[model samples]
Target: MCVVHLLDNPDSWAPASLQGLNLCGECNDQMIADLRLVAARWDDAQEALHAGAGGGGSERHAQRIEAPVPINVSVSDALLVARDNIWSVVLRLVDDHAVQLPVYQDTGSLAEWLSRSQAVKIAGSADKTFTKNAYWWIRDAAGWTVTATHGAETKVDLPDQFCKRPGCNAQLVVVENRAGAHIVQCSADAGHTVQWDTWTNMLKSLGAQKRRGPRLSKKRA
Candidate 1:
């Protein structure tokens, strides 16, 4: 479920405790850890919010400075949305999935609790969507936190890949989150996104097919 993870990588290929939760063990652990990090960075994001430097010498000349203006607003908004979604998912995990954990009042507390407890029940939840969505929620939060705290990371454009969305041929970009997770997404606002492993595996499969050559049809009687 993690963006940095390779679908074919055997290192993360452990079976889930429940068949309903399709995520592997590494992804489960990583998801919880990422959630904790999202909470941890909230303060950092707040500190950097609208703290972008303007034309001034007091800017403490650094190699990279926080992004200014619209970028700040966008990152902040994204982080807020991600946080809300994550909390909602956690609540469902506790109430619906029968997790016996106490929901803390503060974001940091609840996040830390999840990190410590590892919320195995979440990984074993009968709700198949929770695992996948929880990971994405934290993933988006982590990326925004990194952007708000530090300037936006360098987004490498995928030259060969273009957005599959019709009328939107924007090049795809590979975004790396604070937790080392990555996603291949459309550079434009089409919201056409693909997981890294999914894209890589597709390329690999196509390459193998090309290498094998096209199958010939047998002569009919």
Candidate 2:
């Protein structure tokens, strides 16, 4: 029943778990788990989309910034799309697989329905690409949830770069501001910073200069 290449162990696909289904045992379980978690996080994502990390209250660990907080409408819109897509998946399960809908249709009920009902019967919805489909769906939801819950930007250190400002020895870190725009700044001083796009251009210019080497003056003679 295998047609596509799988990267995980047992590289080759095995016989379907049930008739007309394409998921292997491990993948089948994973898909159900993903669906269940995605359902559980549905409302949290909605809150994150509208609540805005900068809002008062717990602020959900919102980062304290000196500058006007970046407005990341792109990221917010993406969260909305993720939620809608998740709902679409839930609808498909209902229509195509006869999965029962919860009476309330809220996140809590959706999670409960999946845990109690569909978790056991998702095998009926498996298709050749079911595992991949489930994985792709979970990624966006998980990222948005984590961002909303933590109000933190993922930090990546630049191995080759370090702060040269006096009294500062910290390395450079790259992070996306709330605006969904990338920034490269010193871990210790936000003042020693550059926009990601500007940094990239600077790198390119430096490389060109290095390739051209030092300029030589005409021979004195």
Candidate 3:
């Protein structure tokens, strides 16, 4: 049985109650609830695949692996649950769990990337890194730098707004703009740039609980 605990200050986005309590805090509870729902669907899909594997042929096995998981998620809910900080954490966790789809990496060209991400929407500023969906929402809100390499020339260009080096306060100056991909130099050393999916996976691994209670009622079973 799913338990719903209402927050004293209602965050409509969060679950009424969560699986545990130790980690329940101010803003992230809603994200935890959303994760639970999504995870439950994934588990159910896996179970169905297992159920269909009795004496199955190779074709059946292949189908199970390739078929889309039957998850009935609402886009609106997904958006609402994925608030500012909450969205980042969930997206990071998803990425960590290797659940991301194929999308272009940050190649320094927000416009070109936005063209590829037509299916998704970008909502926030380009200057500010947003979570999975949000990051794609407002592609041009903040200008990014482009670094490309031509046959013999290295070209770099900057958008109105550029990414600041990870630690250092210096702006990311674009040095090249190639047709396909580009590279830029920053004051700080290069760091691993994680995709939104990878970030979502990290949140899942947090192992934090928003609330706690018996998973099911003895009589319900």
Candidate 4:
């Protein structure tokens, strides 16, 4: 992870979040890339600081500073949050930390927000899809079976080595199906069931995929 010195005052910051935008039709890959570049630069700066430097001047002192994580500031807090129907990012500058700012971008439509939220949820599901909490089903010679769900579910079959959850461990097998939903029996019993939000989020994500796959939106202004 990159590191940077945080200014003592939280008020100082550049535009950190995207702002003044409607439902974006696509994603902003360039924006993402730019963010990554910025992160890399910060990482370089931190590395340079870690390497002992001869006593320079105020600039060196400033470079030596490190920023605290989960930084609280009025600067815009950029995010890649998904709403569902429309995907967008924001660069809004927070005026005050006390004010409860909107976590997601304001698209001026609740329906739009709901859709975007659903899409975002689904996108998140696609990340660790093999995990038990994710919506994972298998349709072999038997029939359509759910491998994992909210409660204790099981799968039946011996595929030697297969993923129990849709996207958790890649090395697991369907032990047995107690009910309609298939149960996931993994070699690594990582104590942690699929989170409720993750399950529902997967549904929303799948729904979004049915509509639009990955997209990109850029700042024209």
Candidate 5:
């Protein structure tokens, strides 16, 4: 049977919760090895980040001059990034080899093919989620600033406020801005400006949580 292994670490592969597929022993071993390789790559990348952070040198100086210093991310974060990247390549492979292989056929051969493929080197979509220019820590300014590359660059001046709207619990952005003034109207929607406060007290009040209805007892007929 095809066994789903949890790709959480590099040492050993654990059986996943769901199970149902006919996979040979060799194929299963190949799948586990491929997953371990991916995990290893992620670990190496994280280690590189940590290694770069050590000591006084050109690299350290450069990092200091750079607005946001890149730090080593967690394994879970790396796993997520690897997962997305791997899936994208897998989907493309499936599309290209549609004629030869069935979509739901044994993934062991497919997994082996993927292991030797160049697509494994591709960076995940989440890799760009936190680019160097996206946001920065300004030591002199004493706060973080969104760079021009960020979608919210224009709204950077807006106070960090949460939406107070009952059902629409999305973050509220500054809809109206008064030049050279602290006063502004904030809302997720331009028309839904139900609350108004100074920039200082904008996030003072918290949004009310929605209460769940009581569970109904089973009727014994």
Candidate 6:
């Protein structure tokens, strides 16, 4: 039996695994390659978005100018974008009769799934279901691969140093509200504050911090 690997869900291998598709090795390889192409396209879109958001510039500029604005996309919204991107490629393949696979029962099922908060299981697949905004689908050697791209869970701890504002040496404190929004503020003053509207935004900003290397002066005579 061939195996289908979900790109997003790396941990639960068995759950996304399927069998009895009987696809030939060459056909399976081609399908997997197609799926990877789709993933690459999705990644390229993400990179483009980030670049538009000023992610490709020098570290100093990224920190000074781009740090304030958060991407502000909900997990569900992100998943929708991924689904749309993937479907664009998948639909073409289906139209061309490029590969044989199970027909999707409901054409609008993805939209329905996006609208609802509950998890919905994919048809004819065991131990696999769409939960959160991370779920995705791809054709492979086995049968189908169910995947997810929800942002990884993160733990927020106070930074040792406070205030990114120049000349401020004060310590920082992490303040969170009932809605899960957090702000890192300088204990010395509230004016020097960074607000994170969502946990994902917070994590993104933290992860996007640019590191600087020490500079050496020339010793020319």
Q: lDDT values of the candidates?
A: 0.55, 0.50, 0.27, 0.25, 0.29, 0.34
Better of 2 and 6 by TM-score: 2
Error of 1 at 12 (Å): 12
In the range 112-146, model 2's lDDT, one tens digit per residue, is 56656764444444554543444344434444444
lDDT rank, highest first?
1, 2, 6, 5, 3, 4
Off by over 4 Å in 5: 1-20, 49-51, 54-67, 70-81, 85-221
* Ten contiguous residues minimizing lDDT sum, candidate 5: 137-146
What are the candidates' C-alpha RMSDs? Answer: 10.1, 14.7, 21.5, 22.1, 20.3, 18.3
Top TM-score hit = 1
Go through the candidates in order and give the clash count of each. Answer: 0, 0, 42, 43, 1, 1
Q: Write the residue-wise lDDT of candidate 3 on 9-118 in tens digits.
A: 13323332223321223213333333333322322222333333333222121221334433212211111221222234334435544345335322112223333442
Question: Each prediction's TM-score against the native?
Answer: 0.56, 0.44, 0.20, 0.19, 0.20, 0.22
Tens digits of per-residue lDDT, candidate 5, 122-168, equal 21112322111111100100010011001121232233444556666
lDDT of 4 by residue, 1-221 (tens): 00001112233332222222211222222222323333223222222322343322221212223544322110111110111111222211112112233454322232233223332332232222221111111011011112111113343333443333555555443433234433233445422123222233433444445444432221111
Assess the local accuracy of residue 42 in candidate 1 as a C-alpha lDDT between 0 and 100.
58
lDDT of 5 at 150: 15
Of models 1 and 6, which has the larger TM-score? 1
- The TM-score measured for candidate 2 stands at 0.44
C-alpha lDDT of residue 28 in model 5:
37
- What is the alpha-carbon lDDT for the whole of candidate 1? 0.55
| Number of the top lDDT candidate | 1
Model 3, residue 71: C-alpha shift (Å): 41
Q: Quote the positional error of residue 125 for candidate 5 in Å.
A: 26
Spell out the clash pairs found in candidate 6: 134-148
Query: Can you give the lDDT of residue 171 in candidate 6?
Result: 72
Tens-place lDDT digits, model 6, residues 1-221: 21233222333232322343323344344444534543333333333333255433221211213344443232223334345434543354345445343344121232222223111122212323321111223331001111112232122445554465788878765544333435444667544444332223334334444233222221111
